[model samples]
Target: MTDSAEVPTSRPMDAWLDALSQPTGSPGGGAASGVMLGLAAALMGMVAGYTPDVPAVVAGTGRLDAVRAELLEAVETDGIVSARFGAALGLASDDPAREQRVREAAVEAARSVAELGRIGISLVAEARTLAADGNPHLAVDLAVATEALEAGLAGASLNLRANLRLARVHGASAAMRAGLDEEVGRLAAARTQVERIAAELSARLD
Candidate 1:
């Protein structure tokens, strides 16, 4: 299992993190968000890959292809966002006047992370639904997909929370914090529902 946080930018997950960690101007929250979405899509693709040739599998293949395209796009955007966030964080010199600017930048980054997390959570839900209805011969594949989706969701949530904390500590506006809190709550709820479904499906297969 690849650690999304440690994924290389040259590859995909680690690639974005590497770019974000660099002093260069690349990788941003948008790119990171894209990666999260990509992972969710990849999980779905894995499920489909495990059950190729059947009519139901064929249908899933098309969906997974679309998801892959979207994830690729998301990776680019997430990288850009990560780069911008890194630059913004670096610019905070701790001066009182610069604090507001830093907070605003952090808020933007947090919002981008939240957006990606939301998208990731949604993809997990969709993948779970597809897996449930997908080829029975590949039920174990569905289990794998569920585990991958959970990992993606958890990673995305971590990123979102970290950014939100940065924004709050740096003096982000109350409205911004409230918005983030709301989105995080919603995503958490959605994750719970998806997890329940995945658990049920996995147990049934077992």
Candidate 2:
């Protein structure tokens, strides 16, 4: 991990873009997915902000802003955790202790990425609800949020799959495997719902 002291909180957008464009492994796919999800939450908040000055819209916007903050923090946390997992993998092969550490870290990383997907699913559902009942003029904004949320969830799934492969190779516990499968199922269902809402919004636009 880039020294614990160097864990970034919030950098300029251009700086983040620059780092992601480089061939570095610290802020890889997992971090990118978190960032996208954070952006999606921010967009959802924006849509809510533009809706009629109702308590529900106002409260929902605040919650979306909180989700945005949490996801942005997750982006940094994912980078740090993945770097630690990478370090564990680089330990001497003959060291049984090292192998065990790697396995445990791999499982933890998978769990963390899966949580990101779970959070994205919540945002997707919220956006769908808003689109269904909120101001009609803001349908496009909600649709954009839904699209971004789905993309982020799909990206998280990719990261989750890779870490899951590592967990399988290292023989994760049955409970752990079952929990991960449940999360995956939830995400898949959420994605389906988001797609249906998106299609309905598209038809409205047409």
Candidate 3:
């Protein structure tokens, strides 16, 4: 077991799972989404490693390295932001500054999750590309990677929706708020594409 001060990623698998099993709302859905994204990235990198001679594979692997790093980092930061968001919500309802506090925390939380969702969604195109060009023998790994990306996208989008609702779109410019729904729709669409690809690969492999 890792020290209490360590983040979830720093802990051994069982310890991290135990922490997640606890009632704490943090290291929750958003963090889980980030982890899924990280998994997708790592798997993609492995697929790319099998075809390192391809220029595109080399470039894509480089990008995946960055994505994986960011996703893992977000796993910790998002958890912290979520914990703060919950704390803000738990403040006494009658507090004079409750509305402002909640709104700020909610926006922060929403933005954090929104960023994670966007990062996951950004990789969908790369995943599709890899499905055809990467090592054919790694099709199963590609399928799993795509599925993980889809799950990450779905999870992050749902978490974003919840945070947006909690804030009632507060503190956002009118245009930003208006576009939020459209962004969420795009995430859903991207995830759907990923899911379809994964299913195709699974069927072919079977």
Candidate 4:
């Protein structure tokens, strides 16, 4: 089995962690969250097999396979964006308006992270449907998977908010802040939905 913290791809898990553990920034929390999201999708695919509807199960399995692949891609993207943001922060002191460049770069990274968070939420929502309709015998597994996805979404949100805080310190435009607020609001609703699904699944398990 692959390590949960590493990207769910062909690369060895330890190889990914070797890079993540480095003092350098990229492949940090944001990337790890993406990995978790992919893992959740994998779990969702497993539980989908337990559903009574053969066609729906096949469709869910295929959908989750695609979702997992996309999430793995996002893991790489997050690392790339983090590197870019780190580079921006490295602007030489002699460079005129260096602070402005860093702020802009930071906001761009934060936006991407927030967008990934939104994607993670959507993936969870899709999984919730499958889990809700899964076999009662596997209810606990479904519930655990939902919780794992929720935790991953929450982690992504934390990273996004941290970047946004930096952007605020750099005096981000009011409109940009408003856009972030709206994104966060949407994530909040998704969380509530997951909680309800988890509750329903848990009730069935009992």
Candidate 5:
């Protein structure tokens, strides 16, 4: 059995999340989007790993491969941006004006993270649809994929909300908060959808 912690980062998908957790770098929003996308792809991979030679695998090959590649790339990019944003946040001076600047920077970071979370919702939806339609023989794997995607979506949404709060503190206008509220609502909806899908799939499997 492969130990997840021992998995090599050089492999396309694994590196992004690994890099995100590291103390040294970015992997903020862009990287986070990639990570979420990668996670969706990873779930797809799990489905593939179990489904064997089903026709859907061949039909959906291109889409799955593309998602997988994009996820890896996104993870790397998210890492870079996260690092830069962190550095910028740290550089803000202690003066009142500088404090405002810091808040602005933090807001930007929060927005970025939220955007990634939103992307995750979309990717997870796609993966869920594919898994459901793909191979009944591997229904259990499909169920696992759904669960993983939901976990990623939920985690990303939390990150986004935390960032948005920072933006509100930094003096974002009421308009900004309203827009973010809409996004938060969407995240909640997406999470519910994922959870429902997982439950349905699990019930079917049993």
Candidate 6:
């Protein structure tokens, strides 16, 4: 079995999936979303590379590569942050530091997913452009990439929503809470847009 603590990039698919399936929340849902985002970026890079005739499309390969690297790095980072957040929340209610620990964890957790959401959202326009103009032969790949991007954004929003509740309970400031609320809304809108793009592409599949 791949150690749950190991980064997803280091393990076999089955082993990583096994670790993810366990009750342990270390490589929790947020980490899974990060992997999804990374996968989307990888697929986008392939589509862009194959589109040699379009200089703009080819130019996007560099950005996709950079995004893929950052999102994959986030996969490991989110796992660690998730584990920390879980540990802090697991502290006994009566522990003198329990409230403070939970507050800090919730803040960290929210920030992690918020950043993930932003990075993932950044690719939405690229995916839409690729879907419309990339090599027609790679439509399936583009559609699949859109779906993965949608799923990643959805997961980030879900995780962010969960952490917001924790933050509210632990007394995060209203201004910060409002910012996260806007994040959740933005993620949902981006996911919906990608979902529409995916559906349109899928409809065109032979």
Scored by TM-score, the top model is: 6
User: Model 5: per-residue lDDT, tens digit, 62-103?
Assistant: 666776775565455455556655765676466556556656
| Alpha carbon deviation, residue 180, candidate 6 (Å) | 1.8
Residue 146 error for model 2, in Å?
A: 1.0
Q: Give the Cα-based TM-score of candidate 1 against the true structure.
A: 0.70
How accurate locally is residue 152 in candidate 3, as Cα lDDT from 0 to 100?
93
lDDT by residue (tens digit), candidate 6, 101-175 = 888898889889888888999899889778877998899998889989999999999999999998889988887
* Predicted candidate 1 versus true structure: per-residue lDDT over 32-151, tens digit per residue: 445545765776676666656556655667666777686676556655666666667677486565667667767776676666666666565456556556667666656666665566
- Residue pairs in collision within model 6: none
Q: lDDT of model 5 at residue 78?
A: 52
Give me the overall lDDT of model 2: 0.79
Backbone clashes, each candidate: 25, 0, 0, 0, 8, 0
Full ranking by lDDT = 6, 3, 2, 4, 1, 5
For model 2, residues 1-206, the per-residue Cα lDDT tens digits are 58957877657877878877886556778888888888789877877877766666666877788788888878888888887888888889898788678778888788878878877877875676587666778778777877777889888988888888888888777776668867777777887888888788878888
**Candidate 2: misplaced stretches above 4 Å?**
1-11, 92-98, 176-178
**All candidates in order of TM-score, best leading:** 6, 3, 2, 4, 5, 1
Q: Would you list the C-alpha lDDT of every candidate in the order shown?
A: 0.66, 0.79, 0.83, 0.78, 0.65, 0.88
Candidate 5 clashing pairs, residues 3+ apart or interchain: 26-79, 26-82, 26-83, 27-78, 27-79, 28-82, 30-78, 31-78
Worst 10 residues of 3 by lDDT: 169-178
TM-score of each: 0.70, 0.85, 0.87, 0.83, 0.72, 0.90
Candidate 4 stretches greater than 4 Å from native = 1-11, 52-55, 91-95, 175-178, 203-206
Better of 4 and 6 by TM-score: 6
Instruction: Name the regions of candidate 6 deviating beyond 4 angstroms.
Output: 1-15, 175-178
lDDT of 3 by residue, 1-206 (tens): 86757755545767767767778878788888888998999999999999877777777888889888888887889989989988887889888777888888877787788888878887887787788688889999998998899889989999888877877844545554556667688888988899888888788688
Kindly list the per-residue Cα lDDT of model 4 for residues 65-94, writing each as its tens digit: 888888888889989999988887888978
- Model 6 clashing-pair count: 0
